[model samples]
Target: MDLRPARAHEAGLLTELALESKGYWDYDEAFLAACRDELTLIPADVERRRTTVAEEDGRVLGFTTLDGIPPEGALGMMFIAPGAIGRGIGRRLFEHTAAKARRLGFARLTIDADPNAEPFYRAMGAVRIGETPSGSIPGRVLPLMEYVLTPR
Candidate 1:
């Protein structure tokens, strides 16, 4: 798979990917709805953040959005096409995002992850800091974690 920064043409596909990702949290309809803004905001938000796309055979397979440089970091979004999961696309995206974070002088990378995705982040070296209520759920919550990297 080839990974590169996202371009204007991929905006619609990225929106689709974001919706598909929201579907994974079946128990939380509110969470999905709350994410509506992100789906619409990403393309425009690229002006201030790092957005990368993963492609294989000229097809978009996944994407990752970095909110800011590491240390004071955040992952605005990370989604892989349903058909492309478990093939290392997400890891490559994380590595790419992390490398950029390091270069930008971030010392820690954080993600407010979907509960189902906590394991993957753990494998990537993110230690759970705490859990916070889901944006859409009145009482449901998910893990917040961070991966600490050496200073650049």
Candidate 2:
């Protein structure tokens, strides 16, 4: 798959992909609707947050966003298309995000991951630091993880 920066006009497409990816975990409509805005990829964020897309043959397979200031930032978003999950796309996107974080001088990347994705992040070398409240669901919490960029 090819990894490249996301384009401005592709915001809607990316947002749909994120929602679909999230729904892959079997979340109900109400739950997904509640998370829509929080999962959206705004055009401005494309450049500001360093959004990246993974594609192949001109088809978007996955995407990730590296957010916040250097030396510490959030893996703001990482989603693989429902059809593309389990084919190593998520892993590739995670590695690409981490590499970009390191290049931007980030010493660590924080992740507020869905319970379903916690194991994946852990497999990618992130450790669960605690829990964080969901931006959309008031009573929901997610695994808060940290990935160190500096070499061991």
Candidate 3:
């Protein structure tokens, strides 16, 4: 797969990929509904943040977004198409995001990860720091993790 910056016009396609990837967990309709707004990605977002897509055979298989700068950078979004899961697509996108963050001078990267995605982040070298209230689900807590980029 090739990792490249997301194009302005591919926002809608990326958004669809995000929703479909999320749905892969088989959450109830109400849960998905609550998370809709947070999952939606628009053209403006593409222009505002550092976003990249994993493409192969002219098809986007996954994507990730990075927000903020040094000492405060965050993995804002990451999703892999349902059909592309378990083929190392997510890992490639994540490593790319981390490398980009380092190049941008970030000392670390933070992640507010979904419960189902905690393991992936952990395997990517993120350590649990705490929990934060979910932006979409009432009374839900999300894992807060950090991947330190600077050497000790």
Q: Give the number of the best model, judged by lDDT.
A: 2
Over the stretch 116-147, how does candidate 3's per-residue lDDT look in tens digits? Answer: 99999999999999998988988999999998
- Candidate that would win on TM-score: 2
Q: What local distance difference test score does each model get? A: 0.80, 0.93, 0.91
Give RMSD (Å) of candidate 3 vs. truth.
1.4
Between prediction 2 and prediction 3, the one with superior lDDT is 2
Clashes per candidate (backbone, < 3 Å): 1, 0, 0
lDDT of 2 by residue, 7-76 (tens): 9889999999999999999999999999999999888889998999999999999999999998889999
Better of 1 and 3 by lDDT: 3
Against the true structure, what is each candidate's TM-score? 0.87, 0.97, 0.96
Residue 98 lDDT (model 3): 90
Q: Using lDDT as the measure, what is the rank order of every candidate, best first?
A: 2, 3, 1
Clashing residue pairs for model 1: 70-106
